[model samples]
Target: MPDLSPAAFILLQGARVFAPDDLGICDVLLAGGKIIAIDSAIPADIVPDCQLVDLSGRWLCPGFIDQHVHLIGGGGEAGPTTRAPEVVLSRLTRAGITTVVGLLGTDSVTRHPESLLAKTRALNEEGITAWMLTGAYHVPSPTITGSVEKDVALIDRILGVKCAVADHRSAAPEKGQLASMAAQSRVGGLLGGKPGVTVCHMGSSKKGMQPLYDILETSDVPIGKLLPTHVNRSEYLFEQAIEFTRKGGVIDITSGIPEPIPPAQAIDRAVRAGVPLAQLTLSSDGNGSQPKFDEAGNLVGIGVAGFESLLETVVELVNGYRFTLPDALRPLTSSVAEFLGFDNKGAIAPGKDADLLVMTPDLVIDRVYARGRLMVKDGVACVKGTFE
Candidate 1:
C-alpha cells in the first residue's frame, strides 16, 4: 500500500522534464503511488496541506530500473569465503534504483531462487519495487517449485529465466536447450502477459554469440526472447551484442567494469555503430562479484559492482560522450521498464507511478522516490529496510 495523503503533493518548476511523452512546463501532482494530475499549476489552496518541493530548475526524470542485478550473494568460485553479502535497501535507494530485478549468478546451489524471492519481497515490503529471474547459471536451473517454464508463467514475481552461456562455470546448454528454454519462456510470458525472455548471462568465451545465432536460426522463438547481458564485457562480445541487436534481439550492456574496454566507450561505440536504441539496455550488476580468471580458470582477483555505477554510466554518457539525457536515460529507465512489464515505471505521466530522481546540474542523484514515497533526499537515504 502507498501513502495516499489527502493533500496532493506538488512539485513545481523544473528546468527540464523528460516525461517520456515530452510534456513541457508542467507541475506534477502525486497522490498515493500514482500521479493524479499534470498541469501548469495546481490550486495551492486545494491541497494546502500537501508537501511542496521546488526543483529550482533542475533535471527530474524517472528513477532508474536495473533489470539484471545479483541482489543476493553472487560468487562462490573462491570457496564459501568469497560469497558476497546481500544488498541493503539503502544501497539501492541512494543510487536511485527504485526498481530491481534480482537474479542468482554462478553459484546457484548455494543461493537458491526461493531465497532471491524472499529478498525481493523484503525489499518490496520495505517500499522499493523488486522482482527476480527464475533460474541461474546452470542448465537445470533452481526454482521455487521447479521448472523454469512453470515458474515464469505461474509465479507472481518471476518474470524470466536466466542461464549462463559460453562460460566455463556454466552448463553451456546446447543450441537445442537454448531454443527449448526460449520457447517455454515465450509461452509462459504470453500466459502471464509478461516479457518472457531468456536472459543469457554471456561469459568471456571467444565463441561469441554463435550459440545464440544457432538457437535463433533453428527455433520458432522470436528474437525478443533472447537477451544477452554483459555484452560490453569484451571487444568481441560488444561487437556481437551490437550484431545481435541488429537481428532483432535485445542486448544489455552492463555498467560494471569492462575487462579491456571502459563501459562508457562500449556504450558510445554501440550507439555510434547504429545498434537499435530500443534493443539496448543497461544494468549495474550490483552486489555481485566481478571475478577475473586465469587461463586455467584460476580466480586471480575480484571487484564488486556498485549500484552508484548505474547513475555514473548515465553521467558519463551525457557529459563526456555527447549523448542527451533522454537518449542515455531511456535504456536505464523506459527501455528496461517496458521490457520487464513494469507498466507504471520508467516514465512520468498522469497515471504512472511517481518513481523519480532529482539530479543536480552535475548529474548527481539528489533525491529519489519509489511509487510516490520519498526514499532518498539530499544525497542520503530517508527510508531503509530493517534488515540492514
Candidate 2:
C-alpha cells in the first residue's frame, strides 16, 4: 500500500537494489523524506501503521536527475507564437525524473530568469527537488541580484550561472569573458557552499569546443568549474567533446539529439577513446524549443522537447547498447548529483533522500517516490501539478 502522508514510515522489502552499484536483495526503510536504513532487518521493528510494500522481484534505483531544463518553458526563436508552455509536475515524475535543474534558454527577454527561479520553487513545493542556474545565453547574465556572484551566493535555489558559447545566437563572448564568468561562479559557489560551476550551453558553430580550451589556456579556472552541455550535437563537436573529457572536464550530452547514431553509441566511442565514463552525463534539455533552420539561417520548423526521450535514452543505453543497469543509470543519477553537490540525492543509501524508482525487469517504470512521497504508482502519476 502507498503512504500518502509525507512523514509516514514506508518499508520496502525483497527488492534488488541498485544503490547505483547493485546491492542485491535488500530492504529499504524510509521516514520523514530520508532513507533511515538499507539492507537491514529494521522492517521487523516497524510500527504497525507503517506502509509496507513487499517487492519480491522488482528493482529499486535512485531517481533520475535532469540537469538542464527550461522549467518555465523556452522559445521565441521562431517568434512569440512559438513559445513553449511551462512543464507540469506530473509530466516530469511520469518520466522518472525526481530531481531537476531548471534554466532559461535563448529567450531571456520574454522568459525571465526570475520566472525560472519561481518555477524551480514550484517544482520543489510540488514534491520534487529542484535547483536552477541564474543566467541565459548572454554574458553579463541577467540576474535577480544584478550580478552572477550575488545571484548564486545569495539565492539558495541557484547553483550557478548558465551562458552560451560557439553559437550564432549567443553574444560571442571571448575567452576572457568566459573565464571571468567561471571565476565569479566559482567564488559565488564557494561562498554559498554550492557547486558554483558555470554551465555553458555549447552551441553549433565553427568554433566548436575551442572556446572552453581557450579559457583553460588563458585562465587559472579549473576545468571542472566549466560544465559544457550539448557536446554531442554534431560530429565535430562530439569529437572535441571527447577530447574535453580526456582533459578531465565533465560534459553533458543531450538525449534526443538529431544524430546519425544514438547518444549511447557516442558514449561507447568515448569509453573506447579512454574517456572516464564518470565524466560524461546526460540531460533531457526538456521543454526547450527544437527549431529547424534552413541554410539561409531562417527557422523552418519548430517542436517542443519531451521528457520521455530522456527515459528512452537510458533504456537504450541498457538494452540496445548493452550497458549494465548501474552503468546506464549513473549518468542520470549519481553523476548529476555529484556534479551539482546534491549530497542527499543520486544514490539509495542511508541518510540520503528517498527519491527512488521501482522498476520491472523489462525496464518499465512501475513506481516513483520523490522525497519519500509516492508521486507515481503503477506507471501512472498518482500526484499532479497544482493546476493539472
Using Cα atoms with residue i matched to residue i, what is each candidate's TM-score against the true structure?
0.95, 0.96
Q: In model 2, which runs have C-alpha deviations exceeding 4 angstroms?
A: 1-7, 40-42
Please tell me which predicted candidate would have the highest lDDT against the true structure: 2
Error of 2 at 346 (Å): 0.7
Best by TM-score: 2
Least well predicted 10-residue stretch by lDDT in candidate 1: 1-10
lDDT for each candidate structure:
0.81, 0.87
* Model 1 vs. true fold: TM: 0.95
Model 2 C-alpha lDDT per residue in residues 44-158, reported as the tens digit of each score: 5667678888877899999999999889988889789999999999999999999999999998899888898889988898899999999899987889999889888999999
- Residue-by-residue lDDT tens digits, candidate 1, 1-388: 3342323465545435667545655677788777777777666555656777777666778988998888887887788888999998899989989899999998987899999999988888888889888888887777777777788889888888888888898996887777777777788888987788888888989988887887788788888878888887888888878888887778888888655766677778877888756777899888888898889998999867788888888888888999877887888888887777678888888788888888887888888888888888898987777856
